[model samples]
Target chain A: MSIVRLLIGGATPRALALLAALLAFLVAAPAFLGPYALSVAILILYFAFVGQAWNIMMGFAGQLSLGHALYAGLGGYIAAGLFFHYGIGPWVGAFVAVAVAVLAGCIVGYLGFRFSLAGVYFALLTIAFSEFTRIAFDHWTWAGGSGGLFLKVQGGVTDILNLRGGATLFYYAILILAVGAFVLCRLLLESRLGRYWLAIREDAEAAQAVGVPVFRCKMIAIAISAALTALAGVWNAFYYNNLFPETAFAMGRSIEITLAPIIGGLGTLFGPIVGAVVLTGMGELFTDLTEHLKISGLKQIFYGLALLVIVIWRPAGVWPWLAKRLGVEERGR
Target chain B: MSGARLEIEALGKRFRGLRAVHDVSFAVPAGAIHALIGPNGAGKTTIFNMIAGVFPPDAGAVRLDGRPISGLRPDLVCAAGVGRTFQIVKPFKGLSVLENVTVGALHRHADLETARERAGAILDALELGDRRHQLAEALTLPDRKRLEVARALATEPTLLLLDEVMAGLRPTEVDRMVTFLRDLNARTGITVLLIEHVMRAVMALAAHVVVVSSGEKIAEGTPAEIARHQAVLDVYLGDAAGDAA
Candidate 1:
């Protein structure tokens, strides 16, 4: 609490100024960057948003889901399907998307937690559900089967209601999403529910003995994580103008969702954001460099090396080390 | 019978026919400090596990103030006014000492603010106020034991079952714990059922003692009575019987 207080009220003026400047930079980024660079910025914000969502389950509650891409993919498909078929806007479709994802999360969370599945078994259960959903989508011709689903492309005027726009619109759209996720994660982390999660994460038995409702808390984590990730999926289909089950619900996509928080800091508030920016920025940079050098696979090698270095140097992730270096008043939990 | 805060009714548990605990029945009258003692692997902690709802017993029942809590989940058992500390001291290692207690305090206290306030008071009572900011993993064994007690006490439990809280403490530390527990019982009238191997602390703190060996109850009486029992002496407290008496 003192740490929370210190960060909120007693932090040095320099740190406050730095934060304000960073916020200003993010808000004004599109004015200075070219269209190509802005697209990369949009990707960073997208990862930042989804990373925070994934962090809620694995970081806050310690429930590992190796199939988090299921939420994003399902959300995108449902919203895109509504827009394509019923002429409905994604704004209205998002609710249905989130509900479907939450339902999926509940089934998995209920089965995993009720049956006492922990660690790898629970991870496998999540993967199974995700794979099942991907397969179901692959054969469903109404949702485009294995071909893919695409929103109407913009040739003239950008429609904000339908989320039909240029790169700048999505840049702000995902910026809002990433910021919303950051705020929500902070709120949950400081609230009573967050304490229960940390308790369960530490030791479920000890938590239960202390009257912490382990199953309920775990389910809530999964639900919230899925709900948030589902929103990202909605934005994803609109921004990219396409949804492919192979790319969206694949195991590789889930790994991409997890990398940011794991690299930044597993359970910290700023870890996902910082990790997203670092990983996404570095990834783009690596891709650009490799393309210039005519080395196609070097980008993957860079990601592997970056993960290895972070794991070896800072096992808790980059956020804690960075926060301490900047004197950000983190309690080092 | 009405005075008894905790009652065990021929409680029995079997680990696939291993007979871990069998037909053990006892009661700690409200405001009493009771002790369950035995040698290693004698199912003393197993009995605590049963009462705390770590798992349901295969046979018989446990009642708290005329309410059956035998088959309830551990959280439900705690919500029914039972709080317990593990024999191995399972503190939430990732949390601070204050946060650890606050988790239990929140069980009864409605909100985080009040739960934190109550947890602070409990820490002060247990002489852990100074170390409340430290992570549970950073604390010494004695502090960890007190932290376990503090965490349990924060639940505002009518019954606090402590499993070997004084096992690894020094003589002075054990005496300090005994004094603190005695004052706590006097002040709060919370019924305590502790499982301890420390004869000095057990003798000092427990009003009633139940001796167990080989998963079955050998004797039950006042501290001095159990300390002088022949079966207890032969099976368990052979040398420490004199010290306890």
Candidate 2:
């Protein structure tokens, strides 16, 4: 009966009960956790939200974007830029960020779809755009150029209203965003457009022959994905209270955002969320191990090994394998 | 019934130096079951592609119901009352059988539930109702072909273009498909333009037959007339046509 469950590929009663338990655990988590643990939890949720956004493009729509950081970087700059120059809060600038990101998506989608750039070419184009933005932002004086944009923290107390606060507010913000994204994606995957996307992903020619507006549907996918990614970017900028084009729009950042969904599962609704939790959770564990041993870069090595193992053992992702083990069947997903 | 539901005028297509289809013209009257027959690389599928707007012909025009459909995108062609099944049976393998059909149903019925219900009916009509929830990839070759036809039928097209719908079927399955195609045309009054190599199906169902060879329409007539055509014997059947006679 819950809206979230209804939105999530029409979750069965058992799935609903499980989801309720998970939600309860997440809600009560902050109460018992210390600041460090809370931050880790927030980071996990943050990645989960972004992962969901990326999943819309690659997972559902089957457009492999390797430079998703383009959206996030652009969104961050817009929000941060507005706040720095016009004294507009990120809350208000979020709209501008979305608009800009959608516009960028349209341009990229137009060029890519128009020229029929697909597969590795599409991925390269996305990376090229992100790289271009990185270079442009590096030279732009209004956003502190290469020096990076830093938001001045007032006093020391948490500023919940302005989003310049402690990690707790961000945790809740990201939690809400992740929930919203999940519901939205669920609704999308069940809709007519989603069906068209699935068809297009399977065979574009056959889809077009069946009256699906293939190019338009793909553009919509890209635009929606960019908008969602931009929202996450805006949040990332405000939460970190700083922006550097190098780190913000880095290709590595895009890869990081996409790694979880790929490792977890490609098209399933909960793949990204589950993947983020596992990935971030393992990352933290690896960092702890490295710290105890006084070694650096162990986390990176662990990530590579994890990815290799997942690719070898569970190519369809952890979610599909886990779902099979759990006897959960979602139709047409 | 009425005149031609689909008209191709001087249709020609080229892939670099190779002429896939050249000045190929044909017409399928409304409510008629038409067959386009040719040997391998004779441009039968190429003509279908042109009519279905897979790509614009280098020269010529396609009109459906007196409306210009040439140079239109494939989806636009479909929207203009054309539905097609691929020669290779390109089913949405990841989706369930019902979902695969539902994608076409969504063209006319925008509501997902209505489209789903319509897709269900189409699957039932195609004798695939029991496997509606099964993934398309899990189906046998015959079932995959059936799913392809089912998906095309769900679009409610005035003209249905089937590219070798009976290519790999067993003899019994081929007979069943022939019966189904005839029944479909009789029931829905939908025009059928099919490319087929099955001589029995061609003789049994096609109201008219057009033969192409080397990217050109070599002959067009009733099935019996095509059977006697000298060029069809020379180019298509070779010694087989002589043996039949």
Candidate 3:
């Protein structure tokens, strides 16, 4: 019975099956798709990865951060600058970017926790810090100030040394990252830290009264969340081959990254992925419809309406309703 | 049985201009039931908060097993073997009854399995085994009070500070709670410092009683002595001393 249950009930087997299906689709995708379609797929996965990383802090740890794009921007700039200036490979640069982002996350976490700032106050602090970083980066001229930095266009499929080889390479690289982010979130959801995080989220004072080191646990959550988001930034820079302070550090970008998890199911393991797919798919449809009809501002109006409807009708997000329908156990309730 | 002793010297707490606890000094001996009784605003809960490291005292020292613990955080104080339950009962509403207890167990026990085992044992002992899987918010008032005790017990504290565990209990429920407290102190040898307004329960359970009125220690004695004392009678029955007769 145990063996039978394990075969049917374990997340591992289900995840493996899903991976196999996705791999099959990816391998056959290029044969049947054009450049635009492939680009859309890459964008979906990129947002999915970022959403998952953000979910770790906001959803799981219950620390609402509104300026997550700051870490992403920092990671992207660090990796892009390292590659452009020192001719360093993105593989090594990604790790350094992640480390720096983790350090920044720790600082933010310390400030919030040490001051006992929580809920909306913590979110405001993150926004304030991100805005500060954005202003500082905008003034720094080494990375082209407010103009931007663009990588040189390469002419081959195998220019792996330059980290701007081919569209197909970028696609596969981001796919791996998306999968890695999902696995990391899954691991966190099932671990001791996850339980501690849930306890702290539920009642921080009570958790401390029970001897849970509230500050240290929160800092750990922030660090892990920042590191993962930074790694996604590395891929973002490499895939686009262009970095700009405004585009990378915009408050809109942070909101876009968070919207996926909010619409998917905040705090649930699969909420970010589900949310990313829905939003990205809808965005693609909206863009195509607007272009064909020559309509102005339709996409923005649609997104705003959708967000309002979701918040009003199903505030828990799409994944929770889907989980109930499909009989799947939800995590971090 | 080998729990640490709690000592408070010159403990004082002020809320703005008013002194809540003034020069309060007491010692909770290991493995004994001590009661702090007072009127509505006698600073009983304030003393508990200061002792449990909820907030630093204005001018005092709290020593746990002879180690100075006045400036430590609540979690640090808990780790050092001091556990307390709030008078209002602050349970993690989203977590299950067992999970709420498990959070306390996680302090001393690192692994989930061991913590679960300990939590299960505590739940059974607290007569909450039937509602182990229920959300804490779903529990009734009496159950919530039981959960508070269970949560504190799971922390494995040497000294337990209970604030009005029998505050709203009926006569039978109060008797049961008194029996449970007595059994816990005798069996686990956990030193109990209870702040209660229920005169009957306090007189029946507490070996030593300390009374406070208007943030001052008005009387300290055994149950019979306190019940017969003129000061306690005046404080409870008011200035009309002839009304008691």
Name the candidate that leads on DockQ.
Answer: 2
What tens-digit string does per-residue lDDT give for candidate 2 at B1-245? Answer: 22238888999889999988888888888899989998999998888888888888999999998999989999998888888898988989888999999999999988788899999998998899999989999999999999999998888889988899898999999999999988888777889988999888888889899999999999999999998788889886577766766
Q: How do the candidates score on chain B by TM-score?
A: 0.94, 0.95, 0.96
> Root-mean-square deviation of each candidate, in angstroms?
3.0, 2.2, 3.0
Between the candidate structures 1 and 3, which one is better when assessed by TM-score?
1
- lDDT per residue for candidate 1 within B16-104, as digits (tens), equals 88999988998888879999998898899888888888899998889998899998999999888888998888898988999999988
lDDT of 2 by residue, A134-169 (tens): 999999999888899998776567766567877777
- Model 1 earns a TM-score of 0.95
Q: Score chain A of each prediction against the true chain A by TM-score and list the results.
A: 0.95, 0.96, 0.92
Model 3, residue B34: C-alpha shift (Å): 1.4
Off by over 4 Å in 3: A1-34, A159-162, A331-333, B242-245
Question: CA lDDT of B67 in candidate 3?
Answer: 94
Fnat for every candidate:
0.79, 0.92, 0.66
Ranking by DockQ: 2, 1, 3
Report the C-alpha lDDT of model 1 over A1-333, residue by residue, as the tens digit.
454552354447777787788889999999999988888788888888899999998988999999999999999999999999998998999999999999999999999999999999999999999999999999998889989997888676678898888888889989988887876787677677988999999899999998989999999999999999999999988888888889989999999999889999988877888888889888888999899999889999987898898889999899889987888756534
Per-residue C-alpha lDDT of model 3 across residues A1-333, encoded as one tens digit per residue: 233332233455555576578768966776777899988888888888899999888887789999999899989989998888888888889889999999999989999999999999999999888888888888888777788877776767666665677778888788788877877776666555776787888888877888888898899999988998898888888878898888888899888989999999888877888898889888888888888889899988887887789878888899888877756555323
What TM-score number comes out for model 2? 0.96
What's the CA error at residue B192 for candidate 2, in Å?
0.6
Give candidate 3's error at residue A168 in angstroms.
3.0
Question: How does residue B14 of candidate 2 score in lDDT?
Answer: 92
